[model samples]
Each structure stands twice: as structure tokens, then as C-alpha cells.
Target chain A: MKVKSIQCKKCAAPLSLHGGGHRIRSLTCEYCGAIMKVQEDFALLGQFKDQSHPDCPLSLGTQGTIKDVLFTVIGTVSYRSNYGDSWTDLHLYSETHGYAWLSYQLGHFTFTRRVRYLPSRNMKQLSPREILRVNDQPYQFLEAYQTEVIHVAGELTWIAKVGDTSILRDAISPPFMFSQEETENEQEYHLTEYIDPEAIDANFELEYDTHRSFVHPAQPFKAPIRKALSKASLIPMALSVLFMFFLTLLNMGNTVLSERITHSQMTGGLFVQDFTINNANHLVEIQFDNAYGSRFQVKDITLFDDTHEVFTFGKKLKVKSSTISSQQGTAQFKIKKAGKYTLRLRAITTRKWANSDRITPYISLTIKEGVMNNRYLKYLFYISIISFLLFYISRYFFNKKRWE
Target chain B: MPNASHYINCPQCGNQLPLTFQYAKLTVCTHCDSTLFIEDDGVRLAGKQSVLSTIPSLLELGSPFSYHKTSFVPVGKVRYAHTIGYWEEWWVIGNSGKGFWISVDEGDFAVEKPLDLDSRDVASIPSRDDLYLGQTITLWKDQWQVTEIDKGKCEGFQGELPKILKVDDVVPFVHLSGQTGQLITLEYLDTGIEAFQGEWIDPFEIKREG
Candidate 1:
């Protein structure tokens, strides 16, 4: 029979009819202790005794104990609007000794239910009273079905009780109507098509029956740090790349500048050479036998004599680089005066580094002129005196505080 | 499918002319007195003299000094200037010889005194009184000696050229020309005496003017 909603006439307290095949001879109100007779059938379903009863009101069930109850939940194949559409799977068996019913309490409502044992699993084949059973006895179904609303956030869950019987069956069948052992003798087939016979006994093993329902959390599930960082997008990465590119460009410019400096100060050679100094024209020429060991271009060539500055030559001096045959190497300069001068030479070989920290040293050389008191020495004397005077005048007032 | 070079004969004057780009019904002939209307493949009438004009001009080249501040003094007596129709002009000159011409615009310039030149007559002067940009001196040959050191009421030439002004922000420039070779541009503010100048901004700047 269907469970109904009831209220006390005096205090207006609500109560639910819960047990299957339950009966009552008389009832008294707890507030007023007044007695009332128990009534049966659908007409008096939700009606209760007055507050004048001596104790709480009770109702009775005319059928035997509720039994063979099944708790089921159906959810949308995808997702849907109904909450109760999700059910539990709890099938029970009962005996004449006591009333048994399956109860599932999810959040608010406790779904108390019982089922009947019909001739077939198909409900359409049996009459109402014949199909519906309580405590191994038959009772007609009360309504289409009872629905108790349970408020839940995401997923629907419940605890199911399937075998609540006063009398114990000698053997119990497996909870589900299918098992791998029962289908062993059949031809090897897909597991989806398998089903087994339903049997019940008091002493038979019963699968653990306590089942809890819970909702699985929905998620884009990221840990706190990772999620926060991802939300910032590619901004940090872009900044890093841009910074690296600028740094690389700056390094390249510096390399170019340093290379130019080295090229201005070095040169090298191998062989006997004749040096000439033209005091009037201020020119010097060095002729030598070319050493063919390497294709060494003169990176820079400078000529210095005693105390004055000769050509501190290089690309800066407008000295064009030339490739000479193995027979000869010639170096020339525009000298201010004729003199025996110390000639310094350097040859820089162009090279690129494969590693970031590779180092390249500047190439250098030194050559001393023979004997100092030559005719060029007199001209140098005058040049030195004039240079001193110019230097003195140029720095005449470099260190003065003005605007004070 | 009409080719651009095809021509038709005029029926009135028996003259042949190519079709003009513009579409029109009647055209006036340039060499004859007649009106011409092209029908099918032939001109039906001859036209009077048609006015002729010269080709229109677009994207004409800019003036000579179109670019500004576009020159680099890479080293001594060597300057590269980016200008009209050229990437850069390289100017090179031996210390004592006349500077070489690297462009059609500017010819050779003289070299006053090469620091490495041998003649004692040549004297050199430091570009600036400051220690910045590595102190460098401008060398003058003995012939061009410092004759006077005037120190009063000195005034620079009133001009907009960077080489003329010595005070107010512009640095002293190395004035180089053919025959003159290399000369220090001493502005009127300099007074040819270093005593009054407190400090120098740059050693010397290389200035190029038309």
C-alpha cells in the first residue's frame, strides 16, 4: 500500500506511514491521551487521530508484511531535470515471521518501500494484489508511485537497505540477477548479454548491502597555482622572449665595436725587411719577403720612432688590406719626419666563437729601429717641443669651477 | 582581343594612327585637317589637329641635401655620408696629401699636418681641452703655424652651419676642404686661446656642408 502524509488534529504535527503490513488496534494521543480506532483503506490514508488520544496515533496494514522490495534509480542517459530519476538498486525478500521493506535515505526523505513477488518479472502479466506483496503476503499498490523529494546540489546519492526480515531465509541468492559462475557452462560470449536465475535462502551468502550514493564533483580541475598562472595567458613568456632578443642584439653591437678596435691596433709578419723614412714627405715604407705559411692579412700596422707618434695604423688609418704573393709583403706609412723609429705590428685573425664564453686575444708585435742619433732625430726634437706647447695650452683651463 | 599596337586607316585622309587609351566616338587628327570616327576596324572621317602634351611626372627625386645628420666619421680623414642616389660616400686622405674624392659632389681636401708626418714645420693642436672621447689633437704643418693668440672681444661668424658656431651647444668641427686640407674650426667664441674655456663637450665633430 502507498504511504501517506498525516497530521495530528490538535497539534498539527506531520507523520508518515512507514512500515509495510503494519496494523494497529487502538491509538491515543500523546498530548491529550484520547483514544481512537484504527482505520484501513485509501479513503482514510492521510487522516490521523485527534490530540485527545492517550498516545501517538497509529495506523494498520491489512496485508501481510511488505517484502521483495526493490529500490531503483533512473537517471537520464545524458542529463535531465528530474532528481528522483536517479534511484538505488536494493531488492529484498521477506517471510511470514516479520515485515521487511527496503529503505533508502538520501538527504531529506527516507524512501520506505516493498515489492510483491509476481509469477513473472514482467509487471503486466499479473493482477495488482497478486503482484504486490508485503511480508510474503499480497497487497494492492496504493498509487502510481510514491516520490519523496530530496534536495541535492550536483549528484544524487542514497543508502539502501534491502533485506530487513524478521524470519531468515535458509539461503540467499546473489544481489544481482547475474553472475560469472552461473554462465560458465554456456558458450563463450560477451558479458553484457549474461543474466542468472534469482534465488533466495536464509543461509545463502548475501553481498554487502550498504550502498551510499554521492555526487561526483564537476571540474576544470586545476591546482591553485597552476590555474592562477594559466589565467595570465602567454604574457610572461612573451616578455621573456622579447627581453632575450633585445639582449642578443645589444651583445652583437658590442662585438662589432670591439672587433673594430682590435683591427685598428695589430699586425704580424715573417722575413728580412728594409725600412725607409722620408723626413720631408713624412713617409715610411717596409719591404719584406712574404711568408706563405698562412693567409694572414695585416689586421693593423703601426710605426713609432723614439719619442714621437708614427702611424698608429689600422683601418682607421685608411690602410687598405692587401693579399701579397709568397714573394713579398709591403707596409707603408706617412711619416711627419725622417727618423729611426720603433715599429709595432699586429695581425688579427678574424674568428667567431661557438660558445658564449669563448675568448679571443688581440694579436701584437714589436720591431726596434737601428741606432737613434740619425738625421731624423733632429727633426723629432723640434716636433716634440711643439707638441708640448700645444698640449700645455689646450689644457690651460680644463679644471675651473664657473657660474659660482 | 585588341592588341595595344594596332592601327586603322582614316577614310577621309588615308592616314593611319594607333588608337588612344581613352574611349571616344570622334577624334581630331593631329597631322591633317579632318574629323575621324572609328567604326568597326576603320576610321570613317578625318579630324583637325589634336593637341599633344608631354608625359606627366610622379615621384620626382628630392633635392641634393635631402637627408640630414646622415654622415659618419668612422676614422681619420675618412667619412661616409649617406645621400641622394648613394648608400654612403667614403672619404679618405693620406695625412700630408690632399684628401681623395669619394663622390661626384665633393672633391679633394688637403691634410694640414699628419701626426705621423716627418716635417718639424708641422705642428698639431688637440681637438679639445676636455678629456672625453679620448683626447685627440689636430696636427698642422709647419707652414700653417699658430701666428696669433688673441683673447678679447672675440666673435664667431654668424652662420647656421654646425662648424661655424663654437658656443651654445655645437662642438668644434674639423673643417676640411680641397687645398685647405684639414683645419680646426675655431669659432669666434674660442678666441684662439684656451684659458677662458672651462671645459669641452666633445673632442671635435666632423661637419659636412654643401
Candidate 2:
């Protein structure tokens, strides 16, 4: 049946069913604000003084095709859960089909419809562990909650009054679900399935991006976030690989210009050992291995090449960590002329914090002419690992915050 | 099989009475008030009276509704009431001319067809009082629970009904339900036990109307 013209009996205001259905039973008049019951004559069923509802992207009377079915938005109802979160349900009416609903919560959308089938088992006895097969699809029990209608607006086919409570039981297998709204008198069942916001927005030709929050709880974005982060990390990772390759190219040499390893003991308060670099075209390195009997702090070690100061160390450094105190210090001395380079070292023989009986310990000294002690490679190795770790950790938390 | 264009002359009122229900044992004359019942010997009359009610159901008597993607035109209605208010059972003639009932109780609606009584053993079925909530009662190898058992009286009726019903006729019916929204109404009458199987529905979900 099609609606030609209808009048509100309460105020005699001309009204028309928004969806063009003559089967409209109870609807509130937009002009004088009176609920009219459609019959031979419109009877005043109730007075809708405060008709309020939440704002939604899909407005009333907005026609959109969902699942290949065209539906008109006829009503909107707001429901507040016990957890302080609320959602809006948009009732869609199809004159030749039936009623369907779209629920929006924080930009997440779900389309639902009342479903009926021959249920073989007792549904009330089912728990989460049990599975219910409907139309060859398996749905697992999720949870049950009670919700109350806080507000409503527009025309709804069923009675939509405020403070009307219903116990809703939900079962799901991802986007698809089986739901039942149980009241004192009747138990209404519905099959609900979620719709992607992007698809819905595209179909309705509406912009919902601004209305959507940064993250949707039910949206599957964590995996995609992780994948994007991994792709982004290729920049830093590639930098590290390139940096390591450069270090490998720079530190390529096996030139031992001069070498000497000699052990000598000095009973005096200080000792000095000299090693000469006979050949020096490449870099020259003068190394010393001092092993003492006990743990002791050593004063500054300085080396002089031909009485010209070459290398020095600041601060009292630690010897060997074990009882056999082993310490190593190196100094680089490069001479343009290939000649004997005499190097001198300084040491302290005082047994401070030492646990040994020998006050004097033997020290070994070696001088190389071609080896260069460049510690940039070691530092670069440590910094690369730390940087990669920090970058990966930041990406993890960034995605977690956005998705959670 | 019942014919959608089936018509007969009423013996009591001498008016055209359309037999729309397949298992209809009773038919009412639209022109004259004649409650006639079909019998093996011949069509007899329990009494001649017209049925009337004030229940405003969109799927009222002689209205069209759809079920399972099929169109059905209701030709009879049964009015019943318990303590709360009145509910209705509209007997519809399906596209195949089969008899089915669309029961409207407040916002809760269902379309049901009569079940075979002799198909199941009812010796173990508990009475409506003994069955608690969440309990199951087996009928014809299917399990259902008595959700609400109330005694309702037939206030009025119109059109064609499967069984002959009159005003002030008392009936005790137990509303049995299973997990799939599968509902069964076990009505106890003087004619013994009667079973009806159906699934609950939302009235607004019914798409077409005539």
C-alpha cells in the first residue's frame, strides 16, 4: 500500500510516512509533535514531548543500498551500556522487504536484522564453548549484556520508548554474529554482521573520516600497522648496513711494521720501557701489556717518541679484573721518515687495593708500525644495535596505542 | 488441498461461504452470520453468528502478509486474551493454499502451522506447572520449554479457522520455546491435545502487506 495523504487526528496536521508505506502504525507528527496511531482515523497514542536522539552520519530519510538492498533510514535510537559507552542505532525500512538496523559506535558500523530458523538445540543452555550452526555458518558465543534505550527520535516501527531495557546476548565468529534481545515477554533474535567503515562511507557517498576516532577497537588494524612499520624501518636498517660496509672498507690492513714483546720487572716506584718503530710508512702502534700481582689503580701512562710527546692517557684506569692483573694500553706514533722511534711509558708500582705479595710486576711492551687503532668501527657497531632497538620499540608502542 | 477460489453455499444462511483453509472444519458466511462446520456426512452448523473484535493488527483478518519469501492472505482470525490484554491468531491462506497462523502477541509475532499429534509420544510430557524456565520438553523428537502457560478464552473470531471455535470457549495453552526461537504451543481442549510449531518474529520485519 502506498501513502497518499494522512492527517494527525490529535492536531489534524497533515503527515506522511517518510518511507511511503501505508502500513505505518505509530508515528510521531513532525508538525504538532503528537504520536498518532494509524487506523480509519489517526488516534493519539501518546505524546512525544521530548523527541531527542544522537547525531549520526546517515541522517533520517537517507537512502542507501546495503547488501544489494535499498533501504531508507526511518528511525534512530540511542542505547547506553553499563560501561558508560553509548551507540546509535539507525533503523532502515524497506517497504517491500522488512526492517534492518545499522549501529554506529565510535565510527564502527554493524548491520543487523532479525533472523528466524529452526533451532535444534536449546540456545539458552549454550555457553561460550559451544557453537551454534545457522545456515551452515558456525557462531561462537561471545557474551551477554543488558542495555537500556536512553533516547530515540524519528519514526520507528516498533515501540521505542525511553528507559526500555533489554538483555542482549551475542555470539560471534569475527564479523558475523548471532544476537538475541530478551525481554520479559519475548525474545527477539537477530543476525548481526559488521561492515567496514570505509565501504559504508563509500557506498553512502558520505565523509566519515573526520567523525571517526584515531583508532577503532573492533577494527583489524594492528597487523597492517605492524607491516607498515616494518617497511618504514628499512630506511634505518639500510643505513646501518651501509655504515657497516663503509667501516669494513676503511679498516682493512695487516701491516705489522715493528713488533716486540718483552717482560721486565722494575722494583722502583716508576718504570719506563722503550720500543722503537724501525719501519714506518703506514701507521705505527706502540702497545704495552702490564700484568701485576694484584688489583691496583695506575697513574697516567704517557709515551714520548724521540723526546717528542706522542700519546697519553688520562685517569687512573683499572687493571685486570682477576688476581693476575692484566692491563693494555696503546699509543700510535707515525714518523714520516722511516727511522727508529724510541717510546717511553710511565707506570705506578704502588699496590693500592692490591691483594698480592709481589710489589713489583712484569710488564710486556710491543710496538707496531703499520697498525692503526681506530675505535670508530667498535662504537659504530654498538650505536647501530641500540638505534635499531629503539626504533623497533617505538614502532611497537605507536601501533599498540593506535590500535588499542 | 484447499482452493484459493473455493466457495460453497451456506445451508443455514444460503450465502456464499469461502473455504480458504485446507484443514478448515469451519467456515463463516461473509454475507450472513452462519458458523458452519465441514463434516463427512455434510456441512453442518454448530450455530450461526458473526465474529467481531477491536484488536488493531496490521495483519488482521483478510490482510496479506509474507512468510519465507511467499505471499499469504489471512482469511480468518482468532482473538484471545489472558490477564494482560488481547492477542490474535490470524489464519492465512498461503500461496500454495495451505493453512498457517500468524500469531500477534504485543510486539512478539510468529507464524505457525499445526503439527501432527500422532507423530510423537506425549506420555512423558510434563504439565505446564512442572516445567521450569530453561527446561526442555520433547515433542516429535524436538525439544521445547513452556515459556508461558496461560488460560485464555476465545473472545471472537472471523473468516475461516481450522477447528470450530465459538465465543467464551476456554483453552489452556503452554508457550514452549527452544533455542532457535522455535516455539510450540500445546493447547489442551475438549478434543484432546493440539500442537503447533513456529518460530518467533518481529512484525516490522514482515515486508509486504495487502
Candidate 3:
């Protein structure tokens, strides 16, 4: 079968067949360590179809016929040295240049391997001492795909297109460098994120099976913890029902009280004052007369919880042209505890104050007791019963399941 | 039964993975991130996978089985067959039957639909040097030879293969010769749409006297 040989496709190393049937479809090339296949029709297929991820500095590999053989090599390293520690280079060349310098070393290891082109005239040839040092270090570049060493020992020979080093350079362009610091900086923004279920499961299974694995304590679903979880799930539902009942009663009472206030009219003053607390225990109403002449505007009204300013009504309030009438302002503050409070009232208008020493109506308040609607009591009763029912129902279910 | 099979090597790391069955469209070496395009043109470097299969029923095989000569001219144009769904296949007659489901063709390149991964779709279709959507590509050996580029077709719709084609529409034919390494020959269909032309050298230039 006259098929397109893999050796003819590459530009570097010769395909030295390593004891394989020539008729076989695919064979590994000994020179470049690349697996060559013979396809009847020449087609540029996918690269890395059967190969591992390329290591930073790749190893050597080849394709195409022996006369047109090409080998490729690639690797990566990090350095703390002045020249930035690591060097990565990939070169491709024909096999005619048999002897190749793998790499060089001053202290540790520095050099090149699987080389097809010689040093340019600008490059200095290694001295005997330098050669000895490189030989002593004895580092050979690996083949590009896998972790295989590259070592060459032979007489030198010249091949066609020795200057085609640029082809290899074009084949394996330098990859973008991401330093360690930059990589970590990038990860900081992405670290506090969720991993997919498969990834989490894999990590848990691989690294910490002891702690992460679900322990089957004889019976899987019949454990006491299962009963606890089942019981706990009912608590929120019962509490929600009781909460809704109290909210309804409070809404009903507020509606009834607002209706009674609507029927009262302004009498004996510019604003009439009326106090109605359904089921009132003790409530008081205070009346204030606007003393400032020529209709003073209401400035700011602030409700304070002692030193804490709770609410402030600072929007505009208009007053009519009357000063002798009783100015009515009602504060329906719910007092959780009976206490005395100073209600400061300040009224100012741009019409101008005639007397600077004139005193405005400010009152001191003391609430002995306030009305309590059945809504709150009803809410408490409902919550207590629901909570008790939930607890006992859960306990009963737990006992029934666990005692089984 | 199996979709396509490609024997490829890692261009960067020299790793090799024979992509077979549904996995032929796209795959990455867990070791390296080098990409791979399933085609029949350019160089099949180490770690590259080429499918080895005969043309399937859907893939049309045109004239001239075999002839050895130095000068081979691409007879006609290699037109792109744009179908809607993913059921379309590109099978070649190599030593074995090989082909791929070209699931996507952006402006510049053609990509194969991948295997059943976590996401039931292709991770990504790789870009080949010569083959692009709407362009006529040739088959070199077992790869694709991008010959002439035709920007004639409007941007294609995105969808699966079977959904795209009418049941009556014919599958395009891929042609090759020992004379020229690649040739994509498309049939003149009455489907009314214009066909993309591949590399065509005038036949009168060479003497067939031998």
C-alpha cells in the first residue's frame, strides 16, 4: 500500500524504524521518538490526537520520510537567577547533522538538545574546558511529548536546509509567560468560589476518604440523625402558621382604631385633639397653643428613644393664620415600659419672630400605663401552642422511628 | 456506528492520543493544552491523529480511483455543503473508513462535534490551517487540503447537522489524486445555492501524452 508516510511531513529528525513491521499502520520513530503512521491519502490530521500534554520544554519527535524528516522538541522551567532562572526552547532540524550538542552547564545545567542546526557565526563555539563542563553535567533534552531523554553521540554530518531553524521556531512559538506571583494574584479573585460536584467528589474521594466518606452505620437511612433531621424540618412550618395568625389580628385591631379616630372633628382649636385607645388602661392627651404671632411654620419633629433618634418627620407642615386657638398634635407612641419623656417642639417661620424671648409650647410626658390589644396576647398564645405541638410531634416521630 | 477515528499526536508535547468513535471531534491531553484539528491538509506532526476509514454511505466518492503521475490538477471546486443539524458526516476512503461530524464552521475554520463529556456538546472545535467554513477544501492524504476560499455564502446558521438539511439534499463529495496530494470535488447540485470552488488549474497546461 503506497500511503503517505509520517516522516515526509516533518522537517527534522530521520525516522529510524525500531524493529517494527514496515507494513504496520503506525510505528514509533527512534530518532525523534515520534509515532509515525502511514495513511493511504495524505491528510493533515489533529495534532496531539494520541499524545499527552506537552511538557513546558518539549521532547523530540518527527514525521515524514527519512529524506525529509523533521523533529520537534519543547520544555519549561522557572529561575531565581539573574537571567530569570529557566530557559525554554524548541528546535526542529533534518537528520543530516548527526552530532548535536544537547546543552551546556556552568554550575548546574544549561544547554540545548535535539538540535538540527549549528550555531550561527555570531555564536561562540565552546572551549575544551567548557565542553568538559557540559559533558560533566551531562543533561540531555527530553523528547517533546513524553518524558524521554535526548542524548546524541556520533560523527557530524551535513544535511540539506541546515538553516531552516526558523521553521522549527515557527512551529513552536514561545508561549505567553505567567509568573508565579501573577498566577497567585489571579487565583485570589477566583479562590472563594464553588467547585463543581464532580470535582468536589473527586477530591474528597482521592485525598481524604476517611473524613469525607459517608459512613454507613449498619443501617443507612434508619440512623437516629435521620430522625432528628425529619423532626427539625417540621419546626419552621408550624412557626410560620402561628406568625400569620398574630399578624392578622394586629391588622384587624389597627383598622378598628383608625375608624374611631376618623369620626372626631377639630373643636376648640386650630387642630382638634382626641385620644382613643381600645381597651385603654391609662392614656393622656396634651394640648398646645401656638404663641408665635402670624402663623408659625412647623420646623422639624423628631421622635427619640432617649438619646437614640428613632424617626424624624422633616417634610413641610403648614399652619393657618390663627394663634389663640388650641394647636393640637397627637403622638401615639407605644411605650414598652412606663417612663417619662421630654417632647421638644420647635416652630419657626420666615415671617420673622417678634420677640426673641417668647416661649413656645413644649411638654414633658409621663405614660403610667398604655392599652394592650388582644392581638399580641393572641399571637403569643398561638406561637406557644404551635411550638409545643411541633416539638412534641417531632419527638413522637423521632421516638416512633428511633425506637423501631 | 462509531462516528470518526483520528490518530493524532500532541504537537507541543509530542503526546499521542488515537481519537476514536464519538471522541474524534475534539480532545485535549490532560497533560497539555495543545489543540488538534481533524483534517487532511498541512503537516501531520507527531501526536496528531488522522482517521483511517473508508467513506461511509453518506459521503460521496467521485471518479478516478488511482493513477500515478507527477502533475495532478484539481478538476473543479471544493464547495462547502451547509446543512442544518449534526447528522452530517465527512467520511474519507483511507486504509480504513474515517470521517468527522463537522459541527461548526465559523468564518475562518471548521470544527468537529465532540464526544459525550460532562456538557453533552463539543468543548471546542479546533482550527485547521487550510479548512474554513464555506471554502472549498481538498484532501491531501488523510487530512484536508484548504485550496480556494470562497466568501460567497452568507453566514451560515448555527444548529445541528440533520436539522439543517432537507431529506433530498445530497452529501458533498471529497476527491483526491496521487498526482496532487489534495482535491475537494463538489457535485453540481440543483439545490439552487451556489457551490464553493476549490483549487482549479487549467487542464490544458500539462500534457497527458504518457
DockQ of each model vs. true complex? 0.00, 0.10, 0.03
Query: Which is better, 2 or 3, measured by TM-score?
Result: 2
What TM-score fits each model? 0.14, 0.49, 0.19
* Residue A227's lDDT in candidate 2: 58
The interface RMSD values of the models, given in order, are 57.5, 7.9, 20.7
lDDT of 1 by residue, B79-190 (tens): 1222111111122222222222222111111112112323342223433333233223333432222322222211111100111111112223232211112223332233
- What order do candidates take by DockQ, descending? 2, 3, 1
Candidate 1's DockQ is 0.00
- Model 3 residue runs over 4 Å out of place are A1-276, A279-359, A363-404, B1-210
Stretches of candidate 1 off by over 4 Å are A1-228, A256-404, B1-210
Among the numbered candidates, top lDDT falls to: 2
* Full-model lDDT for every candidate: 0.27, 0.65, 0.28
Instruction: Score residue A399 of candidate 1 by CA lDDT.
Output: 13
Give the per-residue lDDT digits (tens) of candidate 3, residues A1-404. Answer: 12232352333444433211112233333233333333333222212222222223223332222112222221111122222222222222222211112221111111222211122211122221121112122211111111121222111121111111210110100111001111211210000111122332242232222221221111112345545544564565456555666644543322111211110121221222222334333332222333333444444444444566433434533445545332444433353333333333355443532457464332222222242234454565565556546655755664344223
DockQ, candidate 3, comes to 0.03
